[model samples]
Target: MNLGDLAYPDVPTDAVHLLPLGATEPHGPHGPLSTDTIISVGICERAAERLEGEIPVLVLPAVAYGVTRYGSAFAGAVSISEETLRSLVGEIAEAVGALVLVNSHFEPEQVETLRSTGLPLLDLTRRRNAERLTEEFRAGSCHAGRYETSLVLAERPELVHADRMTALEERRVDMPAAIRAGRTDFVAMGMEQAYCGAPGEASAEEGSETFETLATMLVELIREVAA
Candidate 1:
């Protein structure tokens, strides 16, 4: 169940509360700025639906801004300070005792900030989890590539500009490698158009499959924490 749809009296205090975390950042010319948030909320919604029959589940309204330093050069790349993000999430977690964070924004600062919250998280950035994702994702070139673009296509096709996506050529940059080398921003990392990877290869079918995998992973994390 979605927490936003319920009244205070109908709220289940004992339910497993999922808080989807993401960022308002530029995805590309083809994708919407809310891509990260949409992907995160989609995973939380799917996980909640799958777990509701087995246990009480509440998908909280997503936190749609994060520590998005990399995309700051791009338009609409709104970000909050790490301290602000940590405090905001920490406050919410305190109010909702049984909380699990479902985050899709993979900026290193964002990931580290969430990790500081000490709550259970569906962190796909971890090697074990990253290995389970699509090839483009694991290659670290999936900023607005097939992996993320496909996800947006599946969750909100109307938001994806098909013409722009099809017209863009593949731009492959090893993001993880660049990060290791101390590249701080998207442009510095060679993402001139504020995107990387292969947008032309995205497909909604692949997105649906990827969502299932992401939801399953979230479900597993919730089960471990809720146990």
Candidate 2:
């Protein structure tokens, strides 16, 4: 359900507060601009449903904007600074104990800042490595690519554009090397297309599988942390 349903006049000693952090940015021509937020909220809702009344996970309002520097070259890619994100997360952490942050956009610095709060935090970005799924899908890229495309297709089919799948050749750089140099330098290594992997290969079936696996993993993590 909704946030109003989980309202507690005072401290919600009986339930776990789920703050779903999301982003309102472009996902490419094939996906919606609110793809990140939509996916995050959807996953949180599913997890809440699975847990049922035991945990009483409350769905807080999602943060619609995030630090999306890499995707800035693309249209409709609005982002905030790491400091701002940190402040937002920290404030929320001060009010809650266990937080399941369902993040979609990549912002390592902000996430690190939030993690420093020492509250029970669940970072979904680094939760599950997509290497296995990437190889399994034969997706040449990662961002807005096959995996993401498939995810959107499975989660929100009406948002995907199956007919606009066009192959765009770009140079691929090693992630470890980019990390060593830093994010600014990493931005110079790729095209301005706001994508790296193969979004053309995305399908509803693949999206469904990927999302299901992720949701399952999140459920387990939440239970573990709450215990």
Candidate 3:
């Protein structure tokens, strides 16, 4: 049951409560700042659809703000502290029967905050065939690249500017190296527009395939955690 549709939740006692997390951060010159939220929601929605007859789930409204201190210096980025996100997620999880966290933003501090919640969160960023997808991208960078841009194309096409999503392959930057080097914004990493990886190669079909893999992982996670 969708929580938003109810005046009072008529949720089944055994239903899983999935909280999708997103961030108001820059993706690239062509991608919207809400890319995190949009893709997270699409992943959650597909996962829920996959589990429809197996275990009922309530997909909660997404948390649109998060700790992105590493990218905070970018024009379209906004970040909160890890402590703030931890506190909020913990408090919210307390009210659910079975809880799962679905997030797309992979910032170090944000990921650490979510894991430290000690609340059995389900994040597909590190799981799923996520490794394979990231490996397919340039030096494992996913931000505003083919992977993410494809996801947005599949989920919310209007938000992606196809014309601008071109030739970002030239701007390959190793995000992990940048993080290790303590650089915050894209400009510092030789990516002036805050995007990384190949965008010209992104297609809606690829996005659909990515979600199929991620949603399968989600299903496995829910079964394990809810066991």
| Candidate 2 similarity to native, TM-score | 0.81
TM-score of each: 0.98, 0.81, 0.92
| lDDT per residue (tens digit) for residues 105-150 in model 1 | 9999999999988889899999999999999999999998999999
Ranking by lDDT: 1, 3, 2
Q: Indicate the TM-score of model 1.
A: 0.98
- Top candidate on lDDT is 1
Report lDDT (CA) for all predictions.
0.92, 0.65, 0.80
Q: If candidate 1 were superposed on the true structure by all CA atoms, what would the RMSD be?
A: 0.8
Q: How far is each candidate from the true structure, as Cα RMSD in Å? A: 0.8, 3.4, 1.9
Model 2, range 1-227, lDDT digits (tens) per residue? Answer: 45656445643565666676667665656678777777677677788888887776767788888876666666787778878887887788677656767676655655666576565555654525444344523333355677677778877787776776555443354433455567442246463555556677777888777777667766876898788
Candidate 1 lDDT: 0.92
lDDT by residue for model 3 (110-224), tens: 8888988876665544544456454545365667888889999998899988888974554677887888899866678777777877888888999999878777777888888
lDDT of 3 at 74: 75
Evaluate residue 13 in candidate 2 and report its C-alpha lDDT on the 0 to 100 scale.
61
